[model samples]
Target: MHRLELDGITKQYPAVRANDGVSLRVKPGEIHAVLGENGAGKSTLMKVIYGAVQPDAGTIRWNGSPVTVRSPAEARALGISMVYQHFSLFDTLTAAENVWLGLDKAMKLPEVTRRITEVAHTYGLDVDPQRPVHTLSVGERQRVEIVRALLTDPQLLILDEPTSVLTPQAVDKLFVTLRQLAERGTSILYISHKLDEIRSLCHHCTVLRGGKVTGEVDPTQESNASLSRLMIGAEPPQLQHGTRPAGDVVLAVKGLSLAREDQFGVDLKDIGFDVRAGEIVGVAGVSGNGQQELMAALSGEDTRSPAGSIRLFGRDIAHHGARKRRHEGLHFVPEERLGRGAVPTLSLAQNTLLTRTEAVSRAGWIPSGRVTALADTIIRRFNVKAGGPGAAAKSLSGGNLQKFIVGREIDADPKLLVVSQPTWGVDVGAAALIRGELLKLRDAGCALLVVSEELDELFEISDRLIVIAQGRVSPSIPVAEATIEKIGEWMSGLWAPRETA
Candidate 1:
């Protein structure tokens, strides 16, 4: 009997038909992949399976028995556990407290905390049970979600973009854990746009396009190109990362040391780097290291750095706030999309005001018509899929929302752009689009500081690369001379002794 089966699942929304007559099947001990572009209905289908959303039409069978899973609690009772792309964690709650809410009420909080540690250690996931969700970085929060789901000991696990925020080393560790679970007869429904990962990790693959299944194949026998064709109907556009002589340094950090703001935060220690005009500088590291702290310091979110530590064009701007830096043509796209990059409840037009003020009058009154026009231009330019300018930021899919946030910043045409995880959770096509745009910006003599965990992305777009580990920055290396092996080693703070310029 199949471990799980779905037939003719159809979900209709006012703006789009998210799922249309989609059928899927999974066997026990199988690792099945669901492949699609952004808004291709992969996440929506997963939600239907997890009971987070009710399908307008579908028949679900569990172990040869038809059943209706009305809620997440009911899904968990039926041995189905899901780790969403956008985490379902509460910011005010500690890791253990959030995990405990999804588990049996009879279990004590201390017991849940202990189990979290055990699971984390066993799977090589670094998680702090006592850390509040607000204090955790995107990558660290990913670990907490994984550990929580593993504790459920479910028969079926639905992971949506689980490795999006993880470092290369962390991804390897997670694969081992998933393989072990599959061997123990747990079925996994993995949803990701990463073709290489699906080809290597999944046994079977289901490709989705336009809210329907396009093909099903044994992923082990498929190539990345074949998978891309299945998902997006064509190959992703190749990025042109041609290099030119760099101009004057646009952003320079020297001896940037800052104490952690909270007990759970990582302290920045003597971090230094330089980003020059007409170039892209990529920062690679494991999450929870100092990337968060470094970004805060550079973006002027934290003005606690010592004088002469940070300079833009040789000017002391270490004490400048985000707005002051923005006035000097420095714009940033934060790693956290919904809460930081864009507000959740605000319309797309309103969210534009977070980093833009061109539509505001001298009296500080925002002109709605101008704001909507700007938002519309960004949407059309970046090809963001949404319900026009009035759609709430949270209403769009993760990838679509990412495109909008990135588009919002790129539209500003800043002299220096600091973007963290520019294409996190986005589709292959969208990733290529965003990377190409960044390259265009670089070629136009705009300096860019890109922070991402994806080594492939860094190698594709960056001119120079640096690694961060344990709150310290490594010496810079040209992208032409950098190798995955060397960069991976550097990510662990294993670089040879050298002074960073």
Candidate 2:
């Protein structure tokens, strides 16, 4: 008997039919991949299977028996566990506390904490159980979620964009853990936009498009091009990266040092770099190694740096606020999409006010029509799949929200742009789009500082690369002279004496 089966699953929303007559089957010890673009019904179908959302029409069978899972708790009771794309964790709760809530009541908190440590060590995921969810970086929080689900020992495990924020090394470790679980007879339903990952890690693949299943095949036998065609109906557009001499420095940071805001946070120590006009500089690092603190300092969120530390166009803006800095033409795209990038409950058009003030008059009155028109332009330009500008930021898929947030800042035409994880959860096509837009900005004499854990992305677009490790910055190297092996070494805080000289 198959481990899990779904037939004719259909879900309808006010503005879109999220899933339409979708069907899937997973066998014992199978690692099945669900491949699709943003808003292609992959997440909706997964939610239906995990009982977070009830399908309008469908029949679900578990081990040859028909079942009705009415809630997430019921799904867990039936051996189904899901790690959502947007985390379900509470900000105030510690990692162990959050994990304990999902487990049986009979288990004690201390026992849960101990098991968390054991599982984390065994899987090499490196999760700290006592830290609050709000204190963790995106990648660190991802580790906690994965550990919590692994502790359940469920028959069916569903992971949604699990490695979207993780480093390449961490991704390899996670794949090892997943392979072990599958070998032990756990059926895993994996969802990711990374074509290469699906082709290598998954046994079977199911492709979805326009809320319907388009094809199913053995992923090992398929090429990346074939999988991309199946998911988006075409190959992703190629990015054009031309060489150009960098102009005068637009952003100069020197002797930037700040203490940790909380006990769980990393301190920024003597962080310094320069972003020049017509050049793209990339910052590569592991999560929680002070990237957040550095970004906060650079973006004016944390104005604790000393005077003369941060200079924009030769003006000292070390103590400037976000709004003041933004007014000076420094735009930012934060990594946390729902909370920092856009308010979860705010309409897309209304969220534009967070960064773009053109729709508002000098007297502080917002024009609704202009705001909606601006948002519509971004949506159309970026190809964001949503229920129009009226939809709440939380209503769209993770990738779609990312596109909107990134597009919002890019549309502002800033002299300097600071973006973090530009394509964290986006599909290949959308990733290409965002990258191309960044390159275009560079070609237009705009300075760009991109911070990402994806080395491949950094290598592809950056003219010069710098590594951040343990709250310190490494010497910059031209991308043409850099290799993955050298970058990997620098990520561990190792820099040669010659480079320092």
- What candidate 2 gets wrong by more than 4 Å, as runs, is none
Worst 10 residues of 2 by lDDT: 162-171
Best model number under lDDT: 1
Candidate 2 local lDDT, 89-124, one digit each (tens): 999999999999999989999999999999998877
The TM-scores of all predictions, comma-separated, are: 0.98, 0.97
Q: Candidate 1, 405: how far from true, in Å? A: 0.8
TM-score of 1: 0.98
- Candidate 1 regions with alpha-carbon error over 4 angstroms: 499-501
What would you estimate as the lDDT of candidate 1? 0.92
Rate residue 158 of model 1 by lDDT.
Answer: 93
For model 1, residues 301-357, the per-residue Cα lDDT tens digits are: 999999999899999999999999999999999999988999899999999999998
